[model samples]
Target chain A: MTDLNPSRMAMVPFVSVHDMMRIVNGDGVAETIAAIADRIEADFLRWEQFDKTPRVAAHSEEGVIELMPTSDGERYGFKYVNGHPANMGRGFQTVTAFGVLARVDNGYPILLSEMTVLTALRTAAASVVAARHLAPKDAKVMAMIGNGAQCEFQALAFHHVLGIEEVRLYDIDPAATSKAARNLAETDLRVVSCKTAEDAITGAQIITTCTADKKQATILTDNMVGTGVHLNAIGGDCPGKTELHRDILLRSDIFVEFPPQTRVEGEIQQLDADHPVTELWRVIAGKAEGRTSTSQITLFDSVGFATEDFSALCHVHEAALRTGFYLDLDMLADPDDPRDLFGMVARADT
Target chain B: MTDLNPSRMAMVPFVSVHDMMRIVNGDGVAETIAAIADRIEADFLRWEQFDKTPRVAAHSEEGVIELMPTSDGERYGFKYVNGHPANMGRGFQTVTAFGVLARVDNGYPILLSEMTVLTALRTAAASVVAARHLAPKDAKVMAMIGNGAQCEFQALAFHHVLGIEEVRLYDIDPAATSKAARNLAETDLRVVSCKTAEDAITGAQIITTCTADKKQATILTDNMVGTGVHLNAIGGDCPGKTELHRDILLRSDIFVEFPPQTRVEGEIQQLDADHPVTELWRVIAGKAEGRTSTSQITLFDSVGFATEDFSALCHVHEAALRTGFYLDLDMLADPDDPRDLFGMVARADT
Candidate 1:
């Protein structure tokens, strides 16, 4: 029989921020992104087996806190994340996250890890996964319109996984562009810091707009987006946030992670409720077509979903266990007899 | 300016099972229960200030996992809990939990703690808080049916907070009764091990039913419960799981923590949709009646509300901080510049 004592079943593996960094650096960020992307693909392929729901969110004056939960009948996962756009001025990250993965059979948490860094990696990987099928064939030149926290990961995921040789970066703030250029200085990709959004998308086949504003701003107008390019729009993910003009959404054949959630938080929020967007999982599962024609304007309305977090958590759990980079936290209370919890507390008096 | 480095705002205080026990034992269980009851009462008095919602649950064949979240516009708290009735046979706790408390202003967590032990403390405290208002004056005896993990805490909370001087314990399993009797031998209250449920409620003015079976079990028959006795039904807190008979519910003046939730999960699930049950917060706020006369039967149909967890989290956060009985967990990622997350990870390569 399994030991039902505090010494045996009370500990849960926890990967701290420091340990997460170690795991990423040890395995290489590019490699981690590739592995996570593969896991996301595998999960997407079997999407019908999982239970899904729109995230539960508590919106406040300052920001919103959300709990995104999903389960695959065998494993359950959830991420607690917050987005406070004004937090950056107060010396806090605009977004911070942590997540837990548990066994569905017993509901005991198996792994807990910091997800702020992992989210960036998975977001970029998810974009690349969409691009691999939706972007034009042999696409090599990409435009990144947000030179901020997620820019480098998007640039690297494309450079390493999809073999994009050059990246055109642009930001409203020139300092952010300089920072991205300086960070990518060591990489082999030809990094060009452009002066404007138009300059950034010049001759690019993939345009990724990931700005950090929390308002409706038309970063990509209909005229600016040409045919035969994949637009990965990820920044406008809240109720009142949008990055593309309504004309652009009307012009492109949009694909989304989940329709019910995307209709509220994705760029499609500006379009009619019945605007007819394709579910990305259908394309991934080979049930629908992707990039049907070379001249098609394919746009991936990318709002990060819970399944991607589940995949990232699965990857982090395995990597942490293999590399021994996690702490066993005494997060659960296991009494010798489950009915004697009071006895456990009373006996501690000794 | 506030420091934006990873070392500054990234750490959250984590109170483990060992640390929680230390804090509880250090303060004394009776004192801790009293303090928690005070906090719960205080929060209940101002219940309108909170953003309340029924717990979001994911049920499976083996068990159910739930997330209970609430905020008072300034602070946010949520608990992750699971209930697996067959877990005891598999050498696991029937229920286990953990919770997080965060600052709503910035959406950053301030505390994370194991709540298996704390839940016992708060559940007992909440029961006492209810009994204080609903139980007949000068009631000194409580009949505790199904003496399990929560029996001793209930006994102690009644003994210390509600002036109950004696407790009658009875369970289908004699071993569970003996465990409760043995655990309570050190207390000042009189503990009696009864042969049956009828014998247990012989002279008791308050009755608490908290069995573990996930089915309709008539622990309290309509004829067995006399007039003027307050019933605290907690075990039957999920769909299709009910304790008292429907006839018993029709005769009692039902008071619930949250009516919308209790209508689905509490013992009142057996009743009609618009059963005219009273909200407990109204009584606490002095806006509704509790027990009108000595012959009135008052039932507290508690499915456990999110506000109770929020109050318990507040108490634990304060106590943990006061005693310094917690570990600083590097849970959040705070880069030197919020947008320079990639730079932070890149520099960690060194």
Candidate 2:
């Protein structure tokens, strides 16, 4: 007979941000990102195995906080993320998050880690993953129009993964552009601060737009978009929030994470429901075309799906376990007698 | 003028099960529960101020995992929990959970805490909060069906908050009953183990049926119910999972946490969409009728809502902060150069 005390089942494993940074640094951020990209791509190929749904968002006057949950047959995961566009005024990042990975067999969380930094890494990795297939061949020059927290990651991802050599940066906030340039100072890739979005996209083979605003900001007009440039629209992810002009979407062959979610929260929200777009998984799985021709414009409408987080979470779980960087959390009740959970608390008194 | 080195946010505080137990033991569990009950009531009264939505649930063949998120003006909170009926066979508890509490002003997580222990506390506190207003005056005995993880908490909260002196417990598993009895050895309230649900409710004034099964189980029959019995039906929480017979609901006045959510996920899922059930908030606010007559049988068919969690998280946040039983988590990117989030990743020479 098993003992009925729950004190024995009391520890959970947790990885801190410092530990995560150490792992990212030790593994080489680019290599770590590449690994995560592979995991995301592989997961995307088997998209039907997941229980996918549109994220549940609670919109307030300041911003929105959302819960995105998904599960395969054996594992379950969810991410808690908040988007407060006005947060910079209060010294807070525009987006912040954390997530959990759990075993579906027993409903026990196997891993819990900070996802703020991981989201940045995975978002960049996901963009690169899509661009590698969709961007034109020899796409060495890129335009990044956000120059915020996500700008540097976008630049590095392209430089390390897609072999982009030059990046033109533009932001409404000049300090943001200066900061992005300063961060990329050590990298071999050339980074230029541009005065306008049009100047940033001049001669760029891939243009990535990621401005942070809760309004309908037409950052890029159709006339400014050049042919053969892969447009990664990363911001403008909520209802009533959009980045690309509707004309740009009409001209580009668009690809998205999940079609159902993208229709509401992606740049495609500006387009009609009947608008034809390919699911990124179909392109990754070789069923659909990504970059049909060198002259064709491709757009990756990334609203940050749950499957990417699912992949990133699994990768982090393995890394945290192998590196021994996580603290034990008593989040599960392991009553010696599994049926006697009440006794676990009672034993705590002893 | 703030440094944005990318990882410079206020630390996130955490309260583990041990930390929560210390707070409860130090402050007196009953007092802590009473305090939380007050918080829940206050939040419910200002319902229009909150951003409320239905929980996001991922269901599998074995059980279900859910993310329940809600926010008032200042703070946002969410819980990650799973319910697996077969977990006992694998030596795991039937349920486990953890959650986050974040600031709405900046979208940064202010606290992360284990909700397995806290869930038990909050669920029971919510039951008591409803029973105090809906149950008959001078109610002193509770007939508790299903002696599982949530059984003891229900017993203690009623004893501590509502002055219930005796509890009649029944479970299909005898070992579970023994565990409940053992856990309550330290409490002054009397515990009675009964052979059947019918035997348990012989003369009890409040009948709380909290069985654990992921299927439709008629734990309560209409013939077994009595007048003036405030039935706290807690176990029937999913689409096809219900505890009481449909006839029982027809005979009693039904109340719920959130109607739209309860109509789909609570015991009332067995009823029609236009069923004449009252939101528990209405009764607490004195906007609707509760127990108007001694012969009235009121049912609080609760499928635990996010508002209750919002209250529990806020209470725990303040308590944990005062007790200093929490650890700080670097869950946000506080870039000294906020735009240079990539630089926060210390690059490798390789």
Candidate 3:
């Protein structure tokens, strides 16, 4: 038998947080979000081709860690994400994530990347995709409720992808609203800082709620929401974490990413298990109605599905290849003789 | 507000294949296996403390990819593995794996390691752990029915951990037998290459069947097995794969890792759903009977479980820390203010 060097086969491209930041900045955050939104829209059009499963989660006293996996016949991808609401108080991010993409044919991982930044981009992009299909055609104003880590991305995605010209921001913490207002000062969008959620949603066509609390707090009540509005709820992702009141869901034509998952993790978790909700993919595929009438209240109960992460990973893998912004990580063991794994380890001694 | 740098919180230690090999060689494979086996045993002793679930798998036409996750109160771990029987024909491994270990409190990954080598070590160690409880006290010879990738590790583990003096090997392919024989040439134990399965198990007290076919080929029959022999079946891990005859399973007392998993993926998949089997942890925990008499036929229907991978990851994490054989991967996005994720990405531009 000839000695085969497994180093080449073992090398997997790794995009760290630093590299991910570079990739986002290199293309510009709004441009990157638009590109990922395109990918997400394309993937949603062919959603039936992908394998989708609700994320497997382990809930602890302090937080929950989840593994979300999906495949599109040709490629497979998964993301490891943790949501520790208390982590922020302990000088840690409330959410952190990483993902991998592999070939379905050979089951070899080709790319590993930090999804913390990518997920934020993808989440905002996904919201834009939903709003494009569900929102009123001439919608230009967006009310950003519970302004936090995701506020700037949401504002930009809507501004660049959905053409929203104004954003009204509000959070329980006055400092959070100020931070978001300061960040969006550079963008062309008209930014408004409000003292209350009710004030933020006034006269807005699009309302985005993305609070970071782990409890079931009603960031938007039934009386607060107005007619002919699109609600992009991003913060009520986990089991106990919900943003909108049950009355809001009852009044809206709810669109979800995946029903089985959204029924358990989204704002609709407050609704019945068998509530009639249209899958957003159906709207993208032109099989179902997104927003039937101008006065119809539309709510996108976004829990962030696995396919979105897969699309984000696909985008990152392509960007890494095009820009050369990644390191090759030797993460797999490939011996010349596949059966000679023990021999390879033994030879390492010499 | 203070500017906080999250780079330190984002860095996760990664042990590459080269680093894994260095750690294994530094501690010696057999010694490492013994230490990991000790950890596995200790974990099994407290089996009820863990949150166990069947692996989440995505099966394709060519192969299956799976995510196995388990968590104790303090820590969580998961392994990503794939089984593609045709991969070896294409100059790739039949199986490749990697794993991560994280702190449960913050849900942040602390370590990532290549598990192809660590899996080989853990499988052998797990086998030794089972053999110690199920195999006869005076068992010395082990009949290895399949001389494939896992052959040498199994041999060395039994030889070193269980004091097995001889290993008789047999394979349908002569080259596989020769490979196993050649690899074990430097060991003190006697290596006997036999022509057939029947010849290999002639006078052995323990029989190990580890063939890699994805079909139900009976490597062992009821007629071939004697009274007191312990069977270690490792290869029939997925559905439609079984190494031993159903009649042999009917005759022996079965012990399995996790019943829900073993029932679907282990050799016991050949049996009825209601077929009784003892959980292996019970035997380790002194809660159940093992090897009632010298004549009792004990069959350990081994299907790899998540806890085994967790133990293996735990072992690798410690070894890497002790030997400094790992790289810090910037996989998470940490900002001084947890809510200012967009700010972190924006600052990278300047």
Tens digits of per-residue lDDT, candidate 1, B1-350, equal 32434585899999999889899999999999999999999999999999999898989999999999999999999999999999999999889999999999999999999999999999999999999899998999999999999999999999998899999999999999999998899999999999999999999999999998899989999999999999998788889898898899999999999888888999988887988999888998899999999999999998888999999999999999999999999999988888888878878742
Cα-based TM-score, every candidate? 0.98, 0.94, 0.98
Would you list the clashing residue pairs of candidate 1? none
Candidate 3 local lDDT, B1-350, one digit each (tens)? 43434467788999999899899989887899999999999999989899999999999999998999999888999999999999999999999999999999999999999999999999998999999999999999999999998999999999999999999999999999998999899999899999999999988999999999999888988899999999999988999999999999998999999999999988888888999999999998889999999999999999899999999999999988999999999899888778888888888642
Residue A26 error, candidate 2, Å: 0.7
Off by over 4 Å in 3: A1-5, B1-6
List the lowest-lDDT window of 10 residues for candidate 3 chain B: B1-10
Worst 10 residues of 1 chain B by lDDT: B1-10
Candidate 2 RMSD to the correct structure: 2.7
- Clash list (residue pairs), candidate 3: B4-B336
Arrange candidates by TM-score, descending: 1, 3, 2
iRMS per model, in Å, is: 1.1, 2.5, 1.1
Task: Report, for every candidate in turn, its global Cα lDDT versus the true structure.
Answer: 0.92, 0.84, 0.92
lDDT of 2: 0.84
Tens-digit per-residue lDDT, A85-169, candidate 2:
7777766677777888888877788888888789999999899989988998898999999888888888888899999999999
lDDT of 2 by residue, B1-350 (tens): 44323243647887877677677777876777788888888987887777778888877878888888888878888888888888777767778788888877767788888887788888899999999899988989999998988888899899988999999989998878888887887899899999998999988999999987878889998899988889999998878889999999998999998888898878888888998998888888888988889999999998998888889999999999898877776666565554556766663221
Ranking by DockQ: 1, 3, 2
